[model samples]
Structures are given as C-alpha cells and as structure tokens.
Target: MNIAPRYLGRGSWLARRDPRVLIVGLALFVFSVIQVWDLRILVGLALVAAVYYRSARIPFHSVRLQWAYIVFFVSFIVLANTILTGGDLRDVKSQALHVYFRMPLLNTPLSAESTSYAMAQYLRFLSMAAVGFPIAFAVAPGDIGPAFARLGVPDKFAYALDLTFRFIPSLAADMRATIDAQRIRGYEWEKKGRGPIGKLTRTVPLLVPVTVNAIVGAEDTIDAMDLRAFGTGRRSWLRELAMDRTDRLVLAGFGLLLLAVTAASLTGLTRLWVPPFLLPA
Candidate 1:
C-alpha cells in the first residue's frame, strides 16, 4: 500500500546515472541470474545488488511490500518442491527443519538436497529482484521512453512502454486511496471472514472505485496527448541525453561482468551447490 511515487525526490548516484545504461545493465544481470544455480555466483550477484540498493539510498521499508510476497513465494517453492521431487526415494529428510507430515495423497520422501536446491532457486530470484530495485525506486517512468528510443526501439513502442510504467504507480495509489476511503466509511473485511467468497465480496467496494478512477484517468491522458499533437510527428525527448565518461565506464564494467558470468556458466561453474551442512550424507 506504499504507493508514493518512487523516483520523485531520490538523488542517489544510481538515480543520476543514464537510464539507458541502468536498463541494459539490469537486464543483463537478471538474464544471467535466471540460468545460474551456483550458490557462490548467486551470493556474488546479491552482493552487487546490495551495493546498488545501498547507493540508491531508498528506504528499505518502501520496497518491503514486494519482498514480503517474494518471501511467501520462495517458502511455497521450498515446501512444494521438497515433497514433489522424483527418483528412488531414499527415505531421506531435511536435517535443518525436521518437520515431517504424512498425508494420503502426498507421500514423497524429503531430503536436504531438495531443500538446498529450493534455497538456491529462491536466492537466485531474490538477488534478481534486488537488482531491480533501481528500476522501481530511481528510474523515472518518463525516462523509459527516451531510454528505449535511444536503444533503437520504435518511438511508438517506447512511448507505450513509458506509459505502462507510469500507470503502475498511479493505479496503486488509486487502489490505496479507495481502500482508505472504504475503511473510513466503516467497511470491514476482517469482521466478515466467511472464507474466499466473503473476501471477494468485501473487495468489491475497493475495486469498483479504483477501476472507475483508472478509466477516467486514462481518458484524460489520451485527450491531453491528442490535444498536444502527440504521435503526429517525430517524437523527441525534452532533454537530450549524451553518455558521459562515467556512463561509458559503468557500461564497460557491466560488459565485463556479463562476459565473466557467461564464461563461468560455459565452464560448468554455474552448477547447483548445496551447503555442506544441508547436503544429505
């Protein structure tokens, strides 16, 4: 529900850098992490992400809502994958959290291997998410259009992409405002906890207002754009961007990092790694 615009007042180093470089670097980092399973590589990626997050100077609480869902997702992955892994069942079990449940429809032996693998997968995703913080916290939605255009994307597509990013925060803010207004009017979901159906019904009051507001906002935006002769001619950004020496240096570093990650992956260094304590004997 923390829907305040993320990039309005941020003045961090990453926030001041060229959006094109940031976009490309983050894209590369995310791509590399998706194919990797090695703990060392995952940890390293996480460290790099942490450096950026710290440098961005954005409050951690602002992004905590997203990470909260990520934690739930990772937990579900660990529990589900741990039980569903196939092969010769060794009657193995995880030594870390020694909790075992037996159900009629579910009967698969758990092991430290599955647990470790799941943790690795979770870390891989977490690190990728961390690397994405700058996009959400520092990069203004308006900059995306110019950055993509500079990267050779078509003007129309770049404009659409920029609008998509800008709308996300706007929608979130609208939803939060609707919820707050409903709460003030004495609407309570917790008091009517009659299961999923009740929850759905309760949300109606919040959803209807948000949807109407979104439609109204979209129409206004379209009318304004049309009035301004948008998309009728060559679309140029208000401020032209040129890559400075710092931008060049940062881009070069990202290129080197990409090459190193690719080399490591090809050399079999990106294989799954289970911590010794978590590895089944």
Candidate 2:
C-alpha cells in the first residue's frame, strides 16, 4: 500500500528532462502568484499549479495535510487586514494598508476606497496562498534544486535553498519524535488548558527539541559540504538536465504572462480594481 507520490514522473532521477522548463514553470508559478492582487489571476495560477502537480506526481495528500492551517491563516489575515485598514496606492494620501495602520487622527473617518483596497490586498494574499498550496506539496525540494541552480541563481544561494528544502522532512520527523517523546512522558498537549500561556507551555518544549535537532542537522550538513570541497570551485551537476518541448512551452507561457503583468502594471490597468458587491458600496 505504498501509494506515495514522487516529485518527477517519466524523467531522470534528477529531473533532467528539461531544466529550462522546470525553472520557468516554477518561476512563473511564484512570480505570477505574487505580482498581482487579482482573484482571476490567482485562481488561474492555482489551476495551473494543480495541472503541474498532477504532472509532477507529487502526493496530493501531503499538501492537503495543511489545508486547515492554510484556511485559518489566510482567513485571519484577510479579515484582519480588510476590517482594520483602508486606502489604495492611488489615493492622494495613499497609505500602505496593512493589518495595523497609523493615523494622525484616530477618529478621522476612513475612506471607502481605502477599506476596499485593504480587503482586495488581503484577498490577494489568500489567492497567492491558494495558488501555492500545491507547490508546497508537489515540488520535491531535492528535484528542483539543481534546476534552479542552473537557471542563473547564484551558486551559494542555490545551495542554501537546496539545504532549506532538505530541512522540511527533517523537521517533520523531528517534530513527530519530539511529540511522541512528550506524550510518553505524560504531557498532553491537546488536553492542555486554554489561554496563550498554557499554549506556550505545551509548545515550548516541543519546539526546543526541534530547534536542537535542526542545529545538529546543520552541523552535519556543514561537515559533509566541507568534505565535498564545497565553494572551492565551480562544481558540476551530478547529472545533465535538458529542456524538452513541453518545458519550453510552459516557460514561454510565463514569458507571455510576465509581459502581460508588466503591461498591466505600467498601463494603469490594475487601477481599475473594484470590490465585490458583498463589500460596502
């Protein structure tokens, strides 16, 4: 019953099918999700990632594990930002609306446009999160590192990124072990009392072990890199990754998207944003 999904399908172990395509696909996915405050683009990007996730064969369950967390986090952010803030970048006194805003007159009336922009921006965050759900699950850290490295990302930064990816599984395993150890010692986290202080007591010990383990893992990684002569010179990729027609197509699609976003931002297209009818008119 080992139905676990791997990162790459129908490709070499290192995903050598097409580094260019993977690089562009990943970049497009990230850049597009972040660049806009529009729901249409956000939904479009999420659908695109869903397709990519299926193609990549990354486990859907792995991603769904955090669905509740994502929902809670995004919902909280959107609600807080929208309700507490106001104003758009186009406003004469344009203030960057965030969760908390500083006002010269705390009692001054908030503008409708500011409130709308705040809500829109928060929706923007939710949209990006929705889009990124798959990437968090489907893209294996090991599989994408070399492709990113070859795509002109600085070698040191690439290595750091690779190592950062590697930490996920390590952190997960460490958390499980720590939780089990705590449970065996008669500490019941869920059954713990309410309030922030009780929550802190329950989580503090769990985090300490995870942190210590992370440090130990980092040390091991440093030692291994030193043995391999890391940073001594330009190191060759373990395997030669190439570009396929599909990869080219996807990347080109992103180039087109980049152009579109550039045009929209430059031509004041985004200035036409309007809040949905459910919002204040």
TM-score of each model, paired residue for residue: 0.79, 0.66
The residue ranges of model 2 lying beyond 4 angstroms of the native Cα positions read 1-62, 86-127, 217-221, 273-281
* Residue pairs that clash (backbone atoms under 3 angstroms), model 2: 18-242, 86-114, 87-114
Q: After aligning candidate 1 to the native by TM-score, how far in Å is the CA of 31 from where it should be?
A: 1.4
Question: Model 2, range 1-281, lDDT digits (tens) per residue?
Answer: 21233342434322433645655555665665556655455445556655554555544465554566766776677555544543334533444322233355543334545555545555555545544443443444565567668888877787777767666666777788888999999877887558878888788889888898788768878898999899999866664566767667777887787778767766655452444552343
CA lDDT, every prediction? 0.75, 0.59
Candidate 1 lands at a TM-score of 0.79
